[model samples]
Target: MPSRARLKPRKMPTQQRSKATVEAILAAAAQVFRRHGYAATTTDRIAQRAGVSVGSLYQYFPNKDAILVTLAERHIDAGFALVRLLLREALAETPPLAAMLRRFVLAMIVLHEHEPELHRVLFEEAPLPSHVRRRLRERENELASEVSRLLEAHPEACVRSPDVTAYVIVHTVDSLVHSFVLHPPKDIDADMMTNEAVRMLLRHLTAEGS
Candidate 1:
């Protein structure tokens, strides 16, 4: 018998289609994970929600955790991007430092209010795996660097070093927002809390290099 002829497999889609598939899967996974946390979310469910087969899901994500990590990356990147845009816009408007800080605080508060559920998922529900945490740390460092650059533009400020000051300011604001969402103080009015936080942030940043 003559040797059987072999047919080469068709070439896979270009990188663009692969990216679109990954994005679609991540988006669907986010919806499912949001509705039903990590423990309850399943690969099959993600595939179904994504309008793709299990095999296709695996092509991009080995398992559910991979999808969660992707979502976390996207969310954190988005959050930081929003901060960058807000700061840039405020800078363009040449707002006073105190006013800019107030706007920053309000921006975070509004973000929390705008997507409470997603914020909860990001802050409360989803556990930041080691890899995700590492990425977040890098983002934090970048944010600090950006803040330092921003502060350098304000050379008249009393603060001597922008790097350290930026880190402190970013972390302080993060702590305040996290605390507000987790446990609001009873004695302080919500509006007053935001106001006080903004004031404290400005005072701390502007205080004579103690």
Candidate 2:
């Protein structure tokens, strides 16, 4: 027998390769879905695009739907990270409520603008499988809670119902920028949209309420 180190340490079998191959397949599938739309995408095409065997694809993701769920999970996690960065950066700065909120919202919108494709996949896509949906929902709630906690620390900010308000702010700002990602408004420049969204968020979270 050859020395253990030189023995080419038994290559990962079809099963282990299946996991990495599946990830590549999913990545390819998401691009295909985005480019061709979900209805037109096929597993064989995804496997071909990923440079993996179709058998390898099936070993991991059972079907196209399963791959979509994987893609959704990826987008959700990425979105959460983007939002979290904004929250952390804004909160770290010395505060007057309006300015901090504005900065945070601007940062987040800019992030969306930077990667609209991923943002679209996360927010504009249809329902995912139940388990993935639950996970995404929980992550959304958790991010909202984190923002609320940050706001709550600044009682002078006078955020009414911090939990509710945080959720509303997050959802609203996302929706506003999300539109830019989904449909580039002809008249509204992207920078102007970012500014306007920041203004809107600041007005809500920090401006005097009627």
Candidate 3:
């Protein structure tokens, strides 16, 4: 088997047409990989689904893992956008921290719900390259840094250690949201799960000098 180091995309798109083709290929790859499973999916299948020739697919992605990595990056980028938006507007709002946390949690749920099947394949099933895995960690850290800064600025934040608290909050919210939303228990309501998540974080952060 080929090593993971060879999995990165051959080159980034620089022109309008190239960008469109890359987008189409990634969009089709999400569908193909989700429907067929990662191990069974092939570049030809993705090319056919994208309505582009096999040559065109190879022009951007060197292999199936490259396509998978790009899809993962796109998905993570959307989540990053949500994080930026919350940091931009939500933190400035006068709402309590619980309300803000609820908003963040709900936004994540919406992202997962938008394409649950594809998300499962990319995040849980696909054989992600090392860089792809590292990218995911970097994104988490980026968001954590932003959240830590926000906590420091907020008067209500009682945690003496903003960075540590931010890391815990990011991973906690991410793991619980993915688990309960994707493979939800038969008995618990989704909204209730989300609300409970918000409450859980609020209690930890709001206590005196927590």
TM-score of each: 0.77, 0.79, 0.88
lDDT measured at residue 167 in model 1 versus the true structure, 0 to 100: 87
What are the lDDT figures for the candidates, one per model? 0.71, 0.68, 0.82
Q: What is the alpha-carbon RMSD of candidate 3 to the true structure?
A: 2.2
Candidate 3 residue-wise lDDT, 1-210, digit = tens: 246656777888999999999989988988898899888899999999999999988888788887777788888788777766776576677467777778778866776776788888888888776777888899889888877877776778799889999999888888988998779999899788987888788888888485
Worst 10 residues of 3 by lDDT: 1-10
Candidate 2, 19-100: lDDT as tens digits:
5765687679877877766567788889889998878776666677666765776777776787777777767775776676
Q: Which stretches of candidate 1 lie over 4 Å from their true place?
A: 1-20, 110-116, 182-190
| Model 3: lDDT of residue 100 | 71
Candidate 1 per-residue lDDT over residues 1-210, each given as its tens digit? 111111111133369978787778877887887788767889899899989999987765666766666677777788777877777787677667777777777766664554455556766776656656787789878777767776666644468778988888878777778678656777876589878887787777777566
User: Every model's Cα RMSD, please?
Assistant: 8.3, 8.7, 2.2
lDDT for 188 in candidate 1 is 73
Query: Clashing residue pairs, candidate 1?
Result: none
Q: Which stretches of model 2 miss by more than 4 angstroms? A: 1-16, 110-115, 118-127, 207-210
Give the clashing pairs for model 3. none
Q: After superposition, how far is residue 143 of candidate 2 from its true place, in Å?
A: 1.9
